[model samples]
Target: MGLSLSRMMAVLTKEFTQLVRDRLTYAMIIGIPIVQLLLFGYAINTDPKHLPTAVLVQDQGQFSRSILGSLQNSEYFRIVHVARSPAEMDKLIERGAVQFAITIPGDFTRRVVRRDKPQILVEADASDPAATGSAVAALSSLPIEGLKHDLKGPLASAAPGPQPFEVVIQRRYNPENITSYNIVPGLVATILTMTLVMMTSLAMTRETERGTMETLLSTPLRPIEVMVGKLTPFVVVGIIQAALIISMARILFGVPMAGGWAALILGLFLFIVGSLALGFLVSTVARNQLQAMQMSFFYFLPSILLSGFLFPFRGMPEWAQWLGTILPVTHMLRVVRGAMLKGVGLAEAAPSLGALALFVVIVAGLAVKQYRTTLD
Candidate 1:
């Protein structure tokens, strides 16, 4: 049946009135794009420089000092950690604490003076090779050039092989430099983040909008019960989401699930709980479904930016990196990547798992408190 012009206009006017009345919706419509613009414009940097580096200096030599100085000057490397021993440095790299490690042999100065090709071993955690590629490349040219400055006169004339020292770059983990190996596992974290947070954020708000919240509250249900009841179903949904992503990652992308299945499953459980708890907390703040959706986006933006998913985590400034640590997704990425890519066990992914568990506890506590307050 053809609708009448007057009736269609009336329906259109009603929708417009509802839209205007919903201030949260209006703000989201206008504010999200502006926020995205600022975030992407200022915060996004693909070619990240000044990656965190660790140094194990056994040589107290002018050549070693010159090499380190040149690395700092290149603006590609920042030596944040000075390890006492090579073993300590390996632990640092294993924990994803440092991107690059420079080991200056005890005889570096003597070798350089004698015109011997002393090898300066540089071990790079090549899990995210793109982040370390430029910095590693800089090491190749910067050290040789810096050595020339110090090795002037007869030393310069006697310098062997055009360069003073050899740089042995050991690209550990994902040596083939496959981009998918880094990205596919990260996709598991990213997809779960967007879906779980957005979906659960709407849970309480939907009940409120439909006027079922009061009815539910009036029942003999405690705040914890209410929160759990709302979240339990979503937990199953999260498991389904994880299953799909993991399966596709294996079959379609050929990303290996090399980590212990127990560790991976446990990490996924903690991460999903934390994400769902975050959504519940968001629901407590938002008065309606629109506000819930908007709040979810607000959290999603920073999570994606600072979580080492899109850009390198070490590439961010100290303040930004600190901010990322507070987000659950940050630890989730670490857990998933460490497990999937490095074949790490529960002990290896312990810190990230602990962080996720902590997040879940804190957020769930807040949600329960807010739920009771709302009930009163």
Candidate 2:
């Protein structure tokens, strides 16, 4: 008649025994967050290197030789292949094999000395804007510098010789090159997605594995109420994670918020909801937490690659960029970072906000529906 406090201790002990057997789950719950953060932070750099360039040397003259010499010596371009004509250059770039192709006009030698300047045509694949930039900077500097040296011609001028045309370049978007401006905002999205999804998926799956889900089903609580209650703690975690991330950006990276805080928070909330709902949907379908984690990772890879985090959005092919536009992370990244760093208004982030909101409602509703009714 009285299985009192002493007897209840036996049941709690049995629960502890079951938890201890699943050490892999316990380790993953504790370890993956710290490990992935360190790895992604240090190892994942979008900046590309060793750009492939094809060279076509038309003239064997000293000036042409010097230009070619400079190109060979520079770290930016690796001359993996060569072309003899403009047609060849076109073929090389068109094949999607080369990042840049430099052509020396057949009359380069004669033109340089005779006209006091010869121009070389430098064609680059703008497909990868970031990689192309470094290559262009190196190649462009060589010709002008070579001409200046030749123009001086052992004569020291009292006045600085004809100041060649200069470009007062003004950089846009990310002017300062501070890692934070680009990295911090993207980290907000990435971290929120990773943490909220994994956390929600694991917790729900745990309830099912323990056979407590049937007990919950017996209660009067509706499916929607149960999902909402399960989601509440993770939402709090998402907000706390956001605050810590922003603080890290401010104190460690010196990133400033130039835009309104309300817009940033609103966009972030939608994005988090979408990602978390995706996890909840996965939990409903997966038989175990491992499958749920694997599913999240499956989505994670493409999100990182196509989300414009490690690559320029404009650099991707039209089809690829169109595919990238569908990811909620992509829209959220643009909204939060562009607004916070660039001081962009909601009018500017309107499209991104709209996309994120749509994703949120669709994912959340689907998750609720799937959790309520079995997919079978």
Candidate 3:
């Protein structure tokens, strides 16, 4: 037994052959690492720049123009909208339409000329503090540098001393910049995505592996009916999990539930159903429980990374953002954060909810088609 090199080599060769024959496993062995490398190396980013900003310029004076020019030059703030009123600017920030908003009061230029220390109100969406941290840090220099060129000759006295004006940065949500406020809400999406997709896929694959699938198909139930019946239990489980996470977020972590429960509940339902539909699609493709698990892992990887649960979604490149947009977890995170932190109503949560609905329809349709194919 000690000297059996030939037999060991023979067994090793047989195992290699078996591995090659399992094409799905072979592909996963090669694909998972490549995906991980590309996502972490190229897609993920921490310091996000070019964040969308809106400006409300009440003073059409030279100083106001100079400050706007300085903001554009900062590269961190990209002026996307010129709001007409304070209400409009507030709406932009509330709806997540803009990350930062700058309001130059009507008397800004006059105050600067009188050395009265004018204030520029800068409102930031601080739901994800990391996304706005650098941009907020960059604002400290704007009061001096923004008006440096304008305060010359007659206004030279204003330039030499303390800052001519003040930039008041109001962090809208999570004013304390609490990390748990962001992470706890996001956990709802991440946890549901991880568990629902894996659980549904494994359950379905288990039926097939145990020969229960053939018995199920022998019954007169249509594919869609069968799919619905199978997914019902997982949906209940997902709801329970979501409720537990949200309760902990409120009671344990002190995460605010700012918006009405109606919006949050509707969004939660849609996201849970959508995730389960995706899992059903994976089960349809997989031949066994192992393959189902691997496929679920593949889905989970991108859902966790690109969906902005761990990293800032806007921090990633355009291509990565586009990839994340298609994921249900991305919209789920938005819906959760918007409701829990931002106090967004049903109207504001509508877009993300619509996206999740579309995902459910598309993935569930594909699952039904694949299940029919299996019947044939």
* Highest lDDT model number: 3
Question: lDDT of candidate 1?
Answer: 0.84
Clashes of 2: 0
lDDT tens digits by residue: candidate 3, 1-376 = 3979999999999999999999999999999999999999999999888889999999999999999999989988899999999999988898888999999999998888888888999999999998999999999999878988778888977553759999999999889999899999999999998899989999999998999999999999999999899999899999999999999999999999897577789989998898898889899899999999999998889989999888878889999999999999999899999998988888888889899889889998999999999989
Q: What is the TM-score of each candidate against the true structure?
A: 0.88, 0.60, 0.97
Name the 10 consecutive residues with the lowest summed lDDT in model 3.
153-162
Give me the runs in candidate 1 sitting further than 4 Å from their true place: 1-21, 258-263, 285-288, 345-348
In candidate 2, residue 95 scores what lDDT? 43
1-376 per-residue lDDT for model 2 (tens digits):
9669978998999888876776655555556676466435543444545667788887777767666666666766668887877777766664445766777777876655455344576676552345456656655567456445544553224213443212122233444445556777788888887888877887778878888887888788876788778787777788889889988887888777776576688887888778778888888876687867866775676677667777755455556668779988888777767666656666666778899999988888888899778522
- Model 2 ranges with Cα > 4 A deviation: 1-132, 135-164
**Decoy 2 TM-score against native:** 0.60
* Model 3, global lDDT: 0.91
Candidate that beats the other on lDDT, 1 or 3, i.e. the better one: 3
Candidate 3 has a TM-score of 0.97
Model 1, 39: alpha-carbon shift in Å? 1.7
Off by over 4 Å in 3: 159-162
How many clashes in each candidate? 0, 0, 0
